[model samples]
Target: MTDVEPSTEITGNMQQLIAAKAEELFNLCDTEQKGFIIKKDMQRLRDELGVEPEQLEDVFDSLDIDHNGYLTLEEFTSGFGMFLGDQIDDGNANEQEMIEHNPNDKEEQQLFHDTLEALGAKDLYDDEETIMGLWMKLRENDPVLLRQFEQFIGKITQEIRRSKLDHRSIEAALHSKSSVHESEIKKLYDEMEQQIKAEKAKVLAQEKLKERELREQMDRELRLKEQQLSELTKKQSDLEMKLLRLNLNESETKSENERLQKGLKNLANI
Candidate 1:
């Protein structure tokens, strides 16, 4: 009997970590040769593609979909999450869970929303995450326990292929619910955006129009008050002039009566 030394060739575990850490994975992934690493050698790829080397970055930037700073294995296989878009059990929850769960029956089927929330990465997985998806992710990342304790899971996965159980109904339900939720959120956001924008515009327009209208109304009122005050002032001046003329006429008449009485008394004495 020959004994073999254990080597870390990534066996079956660590695939998720590899997929997640795309830059590091690409750095360590086995290349056809050793030429892909150097930045200066990118000109060779440019030449092979028949584009100018200076335009290489622009071309890659255009092709880069996830914008993760590098081409991941999925990108290399198809393009940007395309491999995972159609995961064998993407829409089936129950059947996918049955095939990918721990075969030893020791671990319960992990729910992504519950488990990822516990790990604080809940939003990162989205609804596409399911039992098989998480199992595949865990098996690809955790190295130490992948060979033995989690080994039987791969065996149970084969049962799904042979089983007669169906999951089309569940997939339809999940997709329908997701679609409705997404539409609701999108509609709410759009409506709020439009209403806020319209309210702001209306308030600004009203303020501008009302400011000048109010100013003009105030000016008209002030002019009318000034005209009334001027008319009252002219009437008061006319009354004062009439009172002065009457006083002068009364003084002249009193002087004439006194002289006439003195003249009559002198004539009688004569």
Candidate 2:
């Protein structure tokens, strides 16, 4: 006999709905939260619910809001409600439903990058501890339901990859723009440096020429002053010799007058 499908069971491949549920499930399963189960490993959820693995298949059907086959926080939380919430109150149905993510959501786009980074960082998907831990945490008891969740995860991962490709394209465009701007700035800077150096050289050459002219003027003035000094010394020597000759002539005249006076006295006495 074919296995009777439960009314509560839902299809796992709905991209719009079930994938979101898987992420939430993983968050709850994250080590920090003891109450959460990781769908990557559904045994944990099974253990938490204390239910057989087959029972989890109904989780997808019962929680699907849009029938898009993807589960949102509400659906997954509804799944978790069986195991984790000790509180009697239903937390926030309307708010949970509003959290539905379409492929175009920017935040979800960011989440795709983050998830890839996370997977790269931990290598958790490849390691056995985390995988087994995931199993123990969300799937051990409900093996069949775990398969459905896995189906949903595969669907989301494909979307995530596509999101990453689009993101890369945009990133490449931005990098190209940045490179162009940097090149322009460098060219401008180089031109300015060259102009400044040329101006400085011109100023230096002009200053040197002015100094040469000033030095030439100074030398010419010194030569003129030296020639004047030499002429003045020769004139002073000639004047000194003329004064000596005039003194000698005056002495001779005085001696002659004395002699004439003596002769006159002698005649008178005779």
Candidate 3:
């Protein structure tokens, strides 16, 4: 809820309980014997929770720390207390209170609200529920933008933790730091765009070259076939001409033989 380190907050026994519960749920959901639970596998749970598909998807994504679409037992175990432990009616009112508490200082809270506003989240607050709801909305509407914001927040959180600055210094530091980060991000984005364009152009050129080569190969094949066909046609014509000449010679020989036979017959009669 507060995005604090679970190791710092969850007791050893609590962690064990969460791990056991996570294993039970993971086993129950993984009915297909795939050793992992996918979105479809969590349908019954989703229906039971009465949450929308997008919300369920967000939960799943959170549990799936590797973003690999499948939640393994280890991943589920590690993330269950952070994400799904609230769903269970553990009768721990204190845990709920802890989750709802605003861990951020006033400056940090203002920065959080301002960042949410910049990201188009309305009616923002420092409370966990409001922030989470907005996150879900952001994930559904513009996941790419949400991811960018998450990166920025992660960086800022790290900086704040490392420096341990007073509340007053935080606002000025955040503004200055955020400005520098935004500039770096914009420059990186432009570079990535240029790289993408170059890669696309290279791919298009390769495709076009391949297409041209294929066309030329087909043309060469066609010409080879034509050449072979012409040779065959000439051979056929030559054979036909030779057969006609043999036929004419045979006719001439037969006529001469007939005339000779007639002469022989006349001589015999004489």
Candidate 4:
């Protein structure tokens, strides 16, 4: 017996339920009052929603549509709605109908492939956490899907290699520019250093010239002072000799006057 498909009303109700849940989760995680959730905040969402360790990356990548590592209100609602749809899909419609409804909505699976392609299969294969987390998702096996995955790997590998080459070219160009700038900086520094040294030498020479002139002026002043002292010493010696001659003349005159007084006394006695 074929299972009866659920009505559109049931699906609509389920969608509303999922959207409400998404809103609750968004509000819970958006603590910054911003309208979106960042990668760090996604952890809280993960914990609250009980997202499985395996599907955690897949969930984050899906809701982060623009791949800016954030989820907006609309993106969260839509992506969570798709997740809810997948969980409740068995009662609603067949796989063909699901695809008919929305062909490019391979949210988890597409994100899985893109994530692998972005990291490069070879690089991520050896990574334990990444491989373990995404291993379950890789087990999906539709022959057509498998073929598409293989084709995608080839295409993505070529693109990755081209991107690497371009990156290397850019780095080389930047290194060349940095080297040229370094050389220019060194040249400027050298020029500035030479100018400083020249100015310093000019200042030093001027100081020495000033010092020599000062010394010459001092010598001239010393000679004048010495000559003045010599003239004063000669005048002092002449003054001392005249004072000694005056004292001798005064003593001789006093003796002669005393002898005249004694002779007058003898004449009066006669």
lDDT of each: 0.48, 0.51, 0.63, 0.61
Ordered from best to worst lDDT, the candidate numbers read 3, 4, 2, 1
> What is the C-alpha lDDT profile of model 2 across 1-270, one tens digit per residue?
112221211212122243455455555445455443333345455554445655554554544545665544445655544332111133233212212211244564464445445444223223222222222333435555445434444544555667788899889988988898898899999999999999999999999999999999999999999999999988888888888778888888888888889989999999
lDDT of 1 by residue, 16-49 (tens): 3324433332344325444233323334454223
Per-model RMSD to reference:
20.4, 16.1, 26.6, 16.7
Encode model 3's per-residue lDDT on 180-211: one tens digit a residue: 99999999999999999999999999999999
Candidate 1's TM-score: 0.32
Indicate the residue-level lDDT of 13 in model 2: 19
List TM-scores for all candidates, in order.
Answer: 0.32, 0.38, 0.37, 0.35
lDDT of candidate 4 at residue 26, scale 0 to 100: 80
Residue lDDT tens for model 4, 1-270: 113334556455544544666787789878887998876777775555445544556677866878988888888777764554333334244322443333233575465556566656555322222222212222342333233334434444555578788999999999999999999999999999999999999999999999999999999999999999999999999988988888888888888888899999999999
Task: Give the 10-residue window scoring lowest on summed lDDT in candidate 2.
Answer: 6-15
Task: Report how far residue 225 has shifted in candidate 1, in Å.
Answer: 1.7
Candidate 1 regions off by >4 Å? 4-191
